[model samples]
Target: MDTELGYSIIPLAILGGAIRVSTPFLFVSLGEALTERSGRINLGLEGTLVFGAMSGYAVAYLTNSPWLGVGAAMICGALFGLIHGVICSLPRVNDIAVGIAMMILGMGLAFYFGKPYVQPVAPDLPAIGFGWWSDIPQVRAALEVNVLFLIGAVLAVVLWWMLRSTRIGLILRVVGDSTDAARAMGLRPAVVRTCATAVGGAFAGVGGAYLSLYYPGSWNEGISSGQGLMAVALVIFARWNPLACFGAALLFGGAGALGPVLQSVGISEGYYLFFAAPYVLTLGVLIATSSPTRAMTGAPGELSITK
Candidate 1:
């Protein structure tokens, strides 16, 4: 009976886990894609994500509103991005180094301020039950999707469209491709890059909010587990496309859920090894897509990593 149950539920478990786990990756990758499109890289998004998680949970606990917490997280994330953008805009400043510094700073600040709120109960984000017609508990659980995940999906489509069709998108593409050309065209690369970084930070903050207000649904330092950093690799794997980011995020999420899904069926052997699947997948993606002599296909011309 147990073995039979495992066979029946494994697919369902993976499906549910994929949707539930992909939200943060979706938001962070989208944000990073936008920033990269403008020829700037914000490694500091990890910091923004962690800080946003802490701030969102703290605000939710105090105000008793999860949405408010999300708002606060976005605001805070924007500020973190703004700081990174401004500093990197300075002469001889390395955006990558600044990003790393911001990550450490954000983590330190979150740890210091988040300590008091660690034990508090915060309001969690709501989910829309898509499995209401199902009689099976596992099916229902698998189908109940979070509102933020839906938002991220829609945002992915909208973002992809905007990048391809809007004036702002064109400008970002121009700036990303050549600073000299953007300048000749009367565009300020510094300003554009800075704003892009801030916007990316905002997206990452929302991702952080989802981490605390949904899924794991709690405030903790370890909640991120490097998902924030993994998003950078995810962007590369997606070839800097917002829509692709969504699909890639789901793939990563499914991989992440593989170990636990198998363990749910009493297949505990190599359970810990299963948890490493996402990282291995990340390695595989980087290896497969990366080449020493050529830029990745569809990569922005001005992207620092590509150069």
Candidate 2:
């Protein structure tokens, strides 16, 4: 029961936990980053996330290929995004409310279809071995990262470049900043928003895929616990930057693993508080970053939530 023991193990525990837990957040945050950059918000990403998880697990279990399941989940997610975009485009419907409804629907559908798939095993994802460079056993073990983690890092750089240097990125940013300005430039705001939402949904779907194929590799009612919603908050905390999302996700992942790490060290007090770490951190970040005293900025202008 040495307090120093927990402190000494913090680095290894954080690294391992970050690897195991950040995949879902990475996917969801990236998706939201794209959607928000386009001047629209798909609050229903929560629904899309759970549905994608169920669909990915079920499909992977049936087909014996986790990759295929991930692809299928992306398709399903895009379809959901398309539906959300279309609905939100309507004159009077509130996007936030629609998102809530979609969440209920998505979860319900997941539970209903997932009923037949209780605890089904799916194929697992492959890991990357950067551990060859590490001589220390703990370092090597902690550095045994997933290929998706690399992909997420690459994606962040690519997205940041795209937003800064690409024409399409410029168009999306312009549209998000101002619908009138977009229209003035002969760009279609609705079309941009719709595409953004679809892409975001696809990312959420991949996030779901990660949950079933990599971290847990099975389908159950409790497979995901509010990851989708947390990703939304994460996007804001990341300041809508995909690269920052990667770092934020890793932070969240470490926070998530605290409970298990504590239990591993034979200290189980306040386990539930450790589980709440990610949410609490997220809320703190949001509060610190979002200041009512100053003009709440950085979000696209056409976005309803920001307005």
Q: lDDT of each model, Cα atoms only?
A: 0.91, 0.84
TM-score, one value per model:
0.95, 0.91
What would the per-residue lDDT of candidate 1 be over residues 42-128, giving only the tens digit for each residue?
998898999999999999999999999999999999999999999989998988999999999999999999999989899999999
**lDDT (tens digit, per residue) of candidate 2 on 1-307:** 2235445576688888898789889988998899899987788888888889889888888999888898989999998888888887788888788888888888899889888777666788788777788566666667777776777778878988898899989998998899899999999888888888888899899888888778776777777888899888888788888888999999999998888877787878988988788778878877776667753566777778778
- The positional error of residue 224 in candidate 2, measured at the CA in angstroms, is 1.1
Model 1 alpha-carbon drift over 4 Å, by segment: 1-4, 286-295
Candidate 2 — worst ten consecutive residues by lDDT sum?
1-10
Query: What overall lDDT, based on C-alpha atoms, would model 2 receive against the true structure?
Result: 0.84
Q: Clash pairs of candidate 2?
A: none
Best by TM-score: 1
Q: Output the worst ten-in-a-row residue range by lDDT, candidate 1.
A: 1-10
Best by lDDT: 1
